[model samples]
Target: MDNHTTIAAYNLAKSAYANYGVDTDKVLETLDNISISLHCWQADDVGDFETKSSSMGGGIQVTGNYPGKANTIEEMRADLEKVLSLLPGKHKLNLHTIYGEFNGEAVDRDQIEVKHFQGWIDWAKKNNVGIDFNASCFSHPYAEDGFTLSSKNPEIRSFWIEHVKRCREISNEIGKQLGTPCIHNTWIPDGSKDTCVDRLGHRTLLKEALDEIFEVEYDTNYMKDAVESKLFGIGSESMVVGSYDFYLGYAIKNNKLICLDNGHFHPTEQVGDKISSVIQYVDEVLLHMTRGVRWDSDHVVTVNDESLLIAQEVIRSGALDRTHVGLDFFDASINRIGAYVTGCRASRKAFLFALLEPTELIKAHEDKGENFERMFLLEQLKTLPWGAVWDFYCLQQQTALDNEVIALVNDYEQAELLERGEVLV
Candidate 1:
């Protein structure tokens, strides 16, 4: 749509929302300030630039051989820059420790340092973006036994503990250099595939390792810590060492942020419900937004019911300021850049729908115990002209509209991705 039509539609939307006491201008202003961190793994399908990299193990897997998978540091950065250009609003980049530029050196996980990621820090600075970090404790020979920090073998466990410690240090440096508090999230794939005879023993080991890793506290101005839990993974169907209960207690006791991955829960469980509950105890929470299909499949996010509910809960609970939003999914089967743009755009639309809600008015009805009125207003809201307001926002931000994204992605794929080289199998 052209700017004239978009503005016209937005005017009508603005007038419609005015009757409900919602200011579209204020909503757009607030939406512009919300930054969604884009995961780097999506560009290359989680194939990091490690010299001695091992095959994806410890329950992690990626399934596709699309052409133009970022096989080098330069290619990955270029693809990420393209993704940024197509997205609206300010955003941060989420990086795993394995994505660091090692210059073809044998930099083991335990030996990685800020020097390894200096290139990424410089690139982020030039592009005007902040960075978040993750300590990759999987896809290594040591993690082949389906345990890292919670491993019964002390040698294997210590390696991962040291790796996480270094990652935290690197994250702090990145934040300090960029003038933002980098959130360092730790997620380990420690679990049992079958009935475990020593559940308590593994949990105890994980706790000890975490305690030791976090012994050196960094300034919050430059860094914050979060622990992520998973229900189960490919090799951890029976028992996951870092369950939600374990991380919840650990985060509360240690005054750390708890990561709520929407895909890391039971298929029937709603992560949106847990957000309100977790924030009552912790000062802040990290949200890894992704979709799951019957399991933790890590599908690209769309503006589905679950996504809308999650955004609504964040707005309804008044936790916008206390929550950090980040994307966490990879789909190499399609155009990688298209996947990134689609996921980011869909996520923003969900939040836009939430922000456009007449929340105060609806809550007033509920507060008065007017159940029928509240239900009616909610059902009516489903038909609101929120998409018109969204189109206007996209125009204002100079991004591709919903209708223009596919053609732009196709042009790039033909001119860039297809020319890169042969397809990977």
Candidate 2:
């Protein structure tokens, strides 16, 4: 779309929204300020720049072998820069512990330090972006037994606890250097394949391990801690140690941020519904947006009913400041950069859709018991020119609009990704 056509369409959209007392300018400003953290693993299919690549385990797997996976830190950073250029607003990068730079030296998780990630901090500072960190508990020999932070074996449990503690320290340093509170999230893959008889024992061990890990205090201005839970995974289909109830209870009692992964709940359990309820208890929340077809597959996010509801709840509850959005998917079936752009674009669109909603009018009707008017108004809103506003956003941000982004991805693939000399397709 040309600039003139986009401007004309946006003027129409702006007027249409004004009729419903919605301020398009305010919505655009809000969207501009909102930053979603893009996952780094998406570039290399979760394969990090470590000295040795461990086999995927702990119920996490990235299928397909679409080529152009980044083999070095330089390549990964180059790919990420290209992705950022195609995105609308400024966003942060979420890094797994495995992606730390070790200068061709073998550094195990337990011995990792902030020095290993100094390069990343410098890169982020140069790019003017914030950073979020995660403790990689999977794809390790210790985690192959299907337990970490909740292992009955004291040696194994202590190793992971120390690893997590080090990760928090690293996050704190990164945040202090970058002048943003880095969110350090911990997710464990502890569970049983078959029906485990000693569920209580595992939960008790997990609680003890977490208590030890959180004993060290760090400045909240530098970093905030969060715990993530899952209902089940590939190997642990029977029971998961870090169930939703466990994390909810722990987060509430410990005053920690609770991470609600979209794909980590039962099919019937809506994450959006849980948002309002959880915010009432916890101080803040971190959302890992992904799609689950039949189980927790971690597919790329789409602008679907569930995503809309999640965005609506976040906006309606007035918790935008307290909530953090992050992407969590590794689809190697298509262009990796395309997957990143698609998921991030869908997330922003969802937020834009929510922001364009006439929530105040609908709430007024509900308060006055005008159910039919509320329903009609909401239905009418579905026909609004949100696409025009979105295109305007892309135009203002100098990113490709609609299908045009595909051409950018194709151009990058031809010029950069394919030239990396590791094309799988």
Residue runs of model 1 more than 4 Å from their true location after superposition: none
User: Tens-digit lDDT track for model 1 on 1-425?
Assistant: 88899999999999999999999999999999888999999999888899985798767777777788888989889999989988889899999998988887998999999999999999999999999999999998999989999998989998999999999999999999999989999999999999999999999999999999999999999999999999999999999999999999999999999999999999999999988899899999999999998988889999999999999999989999998999999888888998999999899999999998999899999999999999999988899899999989989999888888889888888888988886565
Top candidate, metric TM-score: 1
Q: Model 1 compared with the native: what TM-score?
A: 0.99
Model 1 Cα displacement at 335 (Å)? 1.0
lDDT scores in order: 0.92, 0.92
Give the local distance difference test score of model 1. Answer: 0.92
Across 1-425, the per-residue lDDT of candidate 2 in tens digits comes to 78899999999999999999999989999999988998999998888777877888889888887778887899899999988998998799999999998988989899999999999999999888999999999999899889999998888998999999999999999999999999999999999999999999999999999999999989989999999999999899999999999999999999999999999999888899989999999999999999988888889999998898899999999998999999999898889999998999999999999999989989999999999999999898889999999999999998889868899899999988887775452
